[model samples]
Target: MTSVYPYLPEMIASFGVERKDVAKWAGATSAVFSVAQSLTAVPWGRASDKFGRKPIIMTGLFCTMCFFLAWGVSTSLKMAIIIRALQGACNGNVGIIRTMVAEMVQERELQPKAFSIMPLVWSVGSVFGPAFGGLFAKPAERFPGLFGNSYFFNKYPFALPNIIGGVVFLISLSTAMLFLKETLHSKRHSRDWGLILGRRITEAFKDRPFRRQQKLRRYSIQDAEASAPLLQTDGTSRPAKAGREKPVAPSMSSVFTRQTVISLVSYTFLALHSVAFDQVLPVFLNYPPQEHTPRNTSLPFFFSGGFGLNSGHIGTIFTFYGITSGVIQFVLFPPLCARFGVLRCFRVCVLVFPVIYFLLPFTVLVENATTRYAALLVLMICKAFAVIIGFPCSTILLTNSAASLSILGTLNGFATTFSALGRASGPALAGLAFTWGVKNNMIGAPWWILGFIAAVGSLPVWMIVEGEGPTAGSSDSSDAESTDAEEEAVVFDDDDDLLDNLTTARRGSGREQQGLLKKGSEDTRNTGYGTVR
Candidate 1:
């Protein structure tokens, strides 16, 4: 996604789009990808549910790598859109990644920090992503010293960035394939050919005898114990049972309970406005430099041209935003969520967005270069902080709202669909608004409109009721019905605990099958809920 951002306008313009229509087409390209994402996120999510998390993740990385390379050499707008749509359709790892994280960090106390990891990684990527998109873009011109005479860089000005992206994806795919363990409890012990083959090759190279190697293995005894029949509480050994009943996927009606619906709706609105702002930033930066008028009292009703930065400069500014945001997220988000509560912090963050949008257009109004840049920096910092807080909070809330782990993939899939629709609409509408505004001499129209949308988005947070974990009791019947008895929760820091627990999953161990430790759920509920006022 970051591979195309910095020079999106130039990229679109190269495809024969009129200068006036480049932004519109750029928005269309992004919207089309999200539209495709909306169509397939559910299926990909369900695939993760049915197959396993690791495989699905690997699949997304591979497909994205291939399609991103296709994106680099696009000859036309339609071709670009087609490649982007294909990319979105083939990749659905986002929700699955969240599901896997939530399962791995089942302890609610750790959720704030745990959930922050994904967005934190995104922030780190944002730092490098735009750098890749910008500095490597049109390298023949940007770095005439090195690539001025090179044929490949000269012929395909934009391909280098995406080539870099594809390499990054390849490395990630290899890493996941070799080391990422499945988090799904049902599939924990399931055979993984990639891991199995990798292990066999490593084992084959060992100089020690097989008997000595087996004796030295730490898990060998544990695996043997797990394979034997589980001992009952009364010291009697129960026969090993066949595959335990797979928990049925909850019906859609059941999954979308009041709290869950609220979470999804709020997330949709959050994605809508947030993505619009993100989409607008690049175009806003790449615009031709215009002299700022001294008549700044017109407020948001009147606005003129942008900072007119080149892709390299834009990349540097974005890198600053990303680095600072990542630091703030890493340093502050967890403690704030822990102290003030996740939902409360999230609600406040959402409320601040409208004001941020209202103030955004003013950045272009300052005529003095030094003052203007300082103001822009402050605003960017504020935006970075709010976004860092808001996103992880949303993830934690939505994750806890799942009816059961058995239904988490489907629920997340459905939620992703809502988010995708919001993302799809954001750019399309913002693009149209931007075009109209630019033509009509109301340059802030899109920003102001998004501000209004942000205000409306804030309304859903008021209606959002936090989802509770299993030990969390409520007088509300809705929450009671949300629980599923058969989906026993087990808190393991890693997959190595699988063998020890497998010995406890016997016919006579129904009571032992309940969540091994239920403290995390209650702690999560208490810490994550609070009044914003």
Candidate 2:
């Protein structure tokens, strides 16, 4: 979509369609794609748990490759839309990949670092996707028969770029299929569906050790109160109770509790703001000048030279942001979380995002070539920081929250779905805002809107609790220990039974050394020791 966006006008012209109509069409397509794409996360996650992560991932990749190939060869709008929809339907691996990594890696301490790498890779993809699109979309006469006649060039000048995208997808698909391994643990076959589901739910509730700790604290308080009379200044004495105290009511885990739900809602808003800003930035930046002049081309060195952004550049920027964020997640975030706590780190990131968006609108204000270039550079740096901080932090929070709930897979799917919805809706909303602003001759208004939206979105981050009970890592460790203990007990019982069997066999066989010697002596003498003589 990033690569082919430049040819939208051309496509509209060829199809004899209005810009508004095209925008509506694209927006609708985006929404549809978003909803379909969201569904893949949880099911893929559950499938990973059921079968294996590797196979499910490979399946998704295969589907993506096929979809992209179809998209590249699409001859009409209907074909393109269908292909795009299919692509959305198939590319549902992100959430699954997140879960797989979480499952495979221990030291919940490493989670932030591990998750950061995803955004980094996405950023790299963003940089290349459009550059390749722009490069390949060049006139066919330039390459002649490089890709056979000028049919593609005539019908769709950007066809080569789409082909490149398809090829990339294929390569990615193959690499994933060959290299990726299953991360989830294998479970025993169970014919009892009710038991399985119930157990999973029960485990989720039980996973939160925070509740247990709370119970212990309450019990300790009660014990302290009960013992207070012994230490009273009046020296009152009471007989000790022989009966045990009633058991305390079980404490509910906070993983899927109200607090977690609020945090998720906050994240949803942040996602909405982030996606909207990302979607609209390019449109706002590359707005055509009111009066066409050669001077307009003198925009800025960054905008004119290597860093210059067209729509493709915008996509590249997003890809860069994604890759950078992913990297931070995989490499930097875990350590940061361990040091600062997830909520603290998340709040800091959320607070900074709006500032970055605010600065983006000012890029156009610096008219001097160097100043304007510097402004754009600053914007990119800030944007990179925003991505790095916001993404990994949010993901860490979500994963941590889910881990607490023992519904990591389900929560992950839900998060992905909401994220997708935001991503899908954001672009269309941004497009609508941009189109309205531009048509109404309200220059730079959309940037302000984006910034304001981002600022408002940050409000939700405040709801997140710091140092909420046990970290996900600690919870997992406790669970592992419990499982080990259970296994050890079973082994101990088996050993005990085996020891009993051996003792019985020895007695039954009369295999004691002394017994054997006495029997042998009695047989030789035809009498027992004293009696034999």
* Ten contiguous residues with the weakest lDDT in model 1: 524-533
What TM-score does candidate 1 reach?
Answer: 0.83
Q: How accurate is candidate 1 locally (lDDT)?
A: 0.73
lDDT of 2 by residue, 1-533 (tens): 33124444333334555543444455444655666777676676556555656677778877776676565556677766677777777765567777666665545566666776666666666666655654565456446667447665756666677778777877776565443443443321112233334334544576476555333222111111112111111122232222211111112353356655765676666766676665455445444434324653333221211123454445454455555545654566567778987678777877777677656654554556578766776666666666666776777666655543235555666667777777677656766765665555444445556667777777877877633323343444465456545333211111123234334444664556445435333322331111101
TM-score of candidate 2 against the unseen true structure:
0.67
Per-prediction TM-score: 0.83, 0.67
Please give the clash total of every predicted structure, in order.
Answer: 0, 26
